[model samples]
Target: MTAMTPTHGGPWTEEEFLALGEDNERTELFDGDLHMTASPTPWHQHVTTELLVALRAPVRARDLRIHAAVNLRLTPARIVIPDLTITTAIDFEQRIVPGSCARLVCEVTSPSNAATDLVLKMHYYAEAGIPWYLIVEHKAMTLRLLQLQRGTYVEHLTAEPGGVLRMSEPVTAEIRPESLLPEH
Candidate 1:
């Protein structure tokens, strides 16, 4: 695990907080602060599963690693469980180990998580130095890609159902939004 030295008033230590994730169902620790996730709706799981299938192929072929709903240690005490994430196998093992290293993070927006995904979680991922972030919206049937530059999201590529998501890092890949989404 990558060690982090907590600042004067930082959240709980990684060990102290992550230890709670095993039994807790709704709550997750983000940088030591607790964040409670609402029960996921069926739509959320459907999209998540579809996206996972789309991603799993490229990752498996290249032997790269990815995870689902896994806690990522953004810092010494700050941890966030992103819905889906991709990272290098080595970095994944060394920096995050049994948790996550999350070079690319994705979240399916739920009514309860839209603001957090667009605002709070966006800042947290940027601050933690994740290279890319993807937000998929259920209502609009859209996919948004954000690439980090200079500690902020500098590039954005958005597409609706028939649009293609072209990406070539962490693993070269393309995704047809419709194939990875449920019919409305």
Candidate 2:
């Protein structure tokens, strides 16, 4: 499906949002509004790739699927494209994955969208009852894991530069914050 030119005059319906299709631009629907962000930087892409590699073994062993940059429908009116997602629901035929199916959603922060990833998306993911949220901070070079507790996200782990983030739940993986950065 080709991406459609979005009309910005009014609130967007799910049908209208879905019809916009997929493209390089990151487009999301929040409360009948359309938000479009620029493409991620090379560093952002590198970190996502490294994290995907690190998580693949455990995810595959558990028979879960890990996808990068795909449409995730949090609600009928709330659709987002998460940086990475680990899920049990594997319906390749569907255009978007239901948020209910996600075991964990990850976001890698960029200077342009730090607030959105750290605050906005975190709240939405928690509100949707997603169990785990992971954030990879670009400038800080740290990895943080947040677990849903009482309908809010609380810090579960934070791995600084030389430190390792070891998690057995969601998926068994050990990641070093420095390992995710691209070589300069």
Candidate 3:
């Protein structure tokens, strides 16, 4: 059984947060506190799986590794687990991947952590100098590509169900937003 550590209060150190995560898969350090989330709903997993399938070809073509939810060390104070991450390294380090090693980080948003994916992670990734960040919305079926420019992420592409996102910055491919939706 996993040891449960409470982190509701503010002001947490990196080591303390990691100790909590040693037994908790959902523990993410954000805003200097541990943010724990409930297990994702079926719909959230569906969207994440679909996106991974759609990205397979492009990911393999570039000789990059595609990983499911994994620890991403965005900063000393911020350690997040993005839904999907593409990295240039073949031998990816287990548990924590340095932000400098990631080619692109993608997060499929669930209601439980949409703000963390869209807003909080954006700032963290930008600060880490990560080149690209992708946000895939669960219900709306939108794929937003944010490219880091100067010192921040500038919106590159935002595609809805009918639209297609032709990515060219961090990676290159044509992605249809509608295909990401799980069929009823």
Highest lDDT against the true fold, candidate: 2
What C-alpha lDDT values do all the predictions have? 0.73, 0.90, 0.79
RMSD of 3: 3.3
Clashes in predicted model 3: 0
lDDT of 2 by residue, 14-133 (tens): 888888877778888888888888788888999999999999999998899999998899998899989999999578899889898999999999888899899889999999999999
Per residue, candidate 3 scores C-alpha lDDT tens digits across 3-37 of: 35473566887777666645425777776877777
* TM-score for candidate 3: 0.85
lDDT (Cα, tens digit) per residue for candidate 1, span 1-184: 1223324365666776645535324445565666666557777888888888888988877777778777677766667777898766644333243333567899898876688788988898898888889888878878888999999986567778778878776666788778876678
lDDT: the better of candidates 1 and 2:
2
lDDT score of residue 129 within candidate 2: 97
Ranking by TM-score: 2, 3, 1
Between candidates 1 and 2, the TM-score winner: 2
Scored against the true structure, residue 34 in model 2 reaches a CA lDDT of: 85
Model 1 spans with C-alpha error above 4 angstroms: 1-11, 90-100
Instruction: Give the runs in model 2 whose Cα sits over 4 Å from its true position.
Output: 1-5
Per-residue lDDT value at 116 in model 1? 75
What ranges in model 3 sit over 4 Å off? 1-11, 21-25
